[model samples]
Target: MKKFIIGLFALVGFSAQAAIINISTDQASYNVGDTITANVWIDIVELQGSNLAQPFIGGFVMSLMADATSLSYNDGSIMFGDKLGAGALSALLPVGFGVYSIQSAAFTPSVFTLQAGLTSFELFSLEFTALSSVSDALFGLTASVSEFGSFVGTPVSTASTEFSVEATSVPAPSTGVLALLACFGMMVSRVKARR
Candidate 1:
């Protein structure tokens, strides 16, 4: 039967090229000496047999670390690891500043498959501006692969993304003196209704 119709068209072309890889960060709501600006993206979604290859080799790279307690991995003056490229995604900058180092090594992963199922997707966005008196700050994302050879069919795994840092509020001073006494009572009731 023609080899079962060419094995059903090669199993529907390897399920239309398998895919799944992600990283995210673009102001999910932060306020505390804010300075969060991140943007990183790399998507392939799915690909295997259909062959949609174009520099597709276990990939991911981007960095910006911060910590002020509870980072986990070790801390030391946090702020070091800024290398983005795996065909480059997108990066803004400014990440949790001052008093942020519990454990951070944001964006640092670039795996290019020498062989194996192949998969790569990373996305990080940005926009953070808060710094009044400080409240909290901690951001992270770590994937590794700049050098470590060994693979013939499937080896490319490195991905991480963490976030925390908030403080950008204003509404005190008696609420701006009650909004200037309700705009001076609506301008004295429109100057007595224009007489």
Candidate 2:
């Protein structure tokens, strides 16, 4: 029993060191009320030479978290294409106050990529509109491999990262005095044209 437990620990440690889940935003910065898309991906190919070759070998499920105070989840933004065909299982919900969760999973024996160079699996694209009252806000969304994180029923490796989301105040229009200018222009045009 002691040897078995030690082996299990070793296995988990090795797998944990294999792959990682990364996050990225469509834009580096956004203005207040501006909608933004966040992407979660399995960045295995990036770790190609560092001991672990192919981080994600098969289909897997990922659960992500966001800060509801700074952002609100948009409906129907998740897109996984053919590999991910979960009817209602893939969804975004408020699992807690001020904290929201997104679930994404895919299963396909024909769509496995565990070889060679940097391969990226786009798990999902989530859209969120900034909702903070402050002039600016900067935060990050995090992700983790769910218990269902597996490649064809076998446990895979994963790591998580905090991607930044910055929101700034939208610039005001510069044409506030356009009406007055237009009236003056009309008068000047009439005067010039009449003369």
Candidate 3:
């Protein structure tokens, strides 16, 4: 029972540090028409004495809001491939025009589990298209991660993150192509005039 008691205390100590889920785009800035990728990550502040040989992440659910004017929701944007939940069950719901929720859980009697240690792994990634230069300039998103707690059955903490999209100037299409098209138009106009 000594090991069990130590493990319990270790869990409590880890939980007290406050687990925070941080959300960020792969790039600090993007250009119009670029594919934007947002990554969700969890960070543990300290690891003292969680005498756990293996730790279970259990499951996670997240919700976020986006700017519909500059963004459109696309299916298959969020993905979790046996990272947190092996053979996990997951669902993505469009709560509103600019809102969404994602919930995932492991198989019952076969739930996903991670070895106990410092926690820093990607939960999932969100894909988006920079519809306008405006949205790219201010791509804003919010998310909250939860499910685990500080007990034998429940073993995790929760936190939230707010992030914004940064965008670079929108570039025009190929300049060479545009120049060729202009030359072609001039040649046709000259031939017509000569006729």
In the range 116-195, model 3's lDDT, one tens digit per residue, is 45456677777777666562333334443333442232323333333344456557889999999999999999999999
Write candidate 1's Cα lDDT for 52-113 as tens digits: 65344332343445453422222221232223333333323344542211111222234333
Each candidate's lDDT (Cα)?
Answer: 0.41, 0.56, 0.59
- Ranking 1 against 2 by lDDT, winner: 2
Better TM-score candidate (1, 3): 3
Regions more than 4 Å wrong, model 2: 1-19, 46-63, 81-89, 113-118, 133-195
- TM-score, candidate 1, is 0.25
lDDT of 2 at 15: 73
Deviation from truth (RMSD, Å), model 3: 10.5
The window of 10 residues in a row where model 1 has the poorest summed lDDT is 99-108
Per model, how many backbone clashes are there?
40, 1, 5
Better of 2 and 3 by lDDT: 3
Alpha-carbon RMSD, each predicted model: 14.8, 10.8, 10.5
Please provide, for model 2 over 1-195, each residue's C-alpha lDDT reduced to its tens digit, 9 standing for 90 to 100.
999999999999887644556666777666667786776666655434466545433344444555667777777766653434333245566667555566555454333432234465666666778775433443344554432235243333433333344455467656858878898999999999988
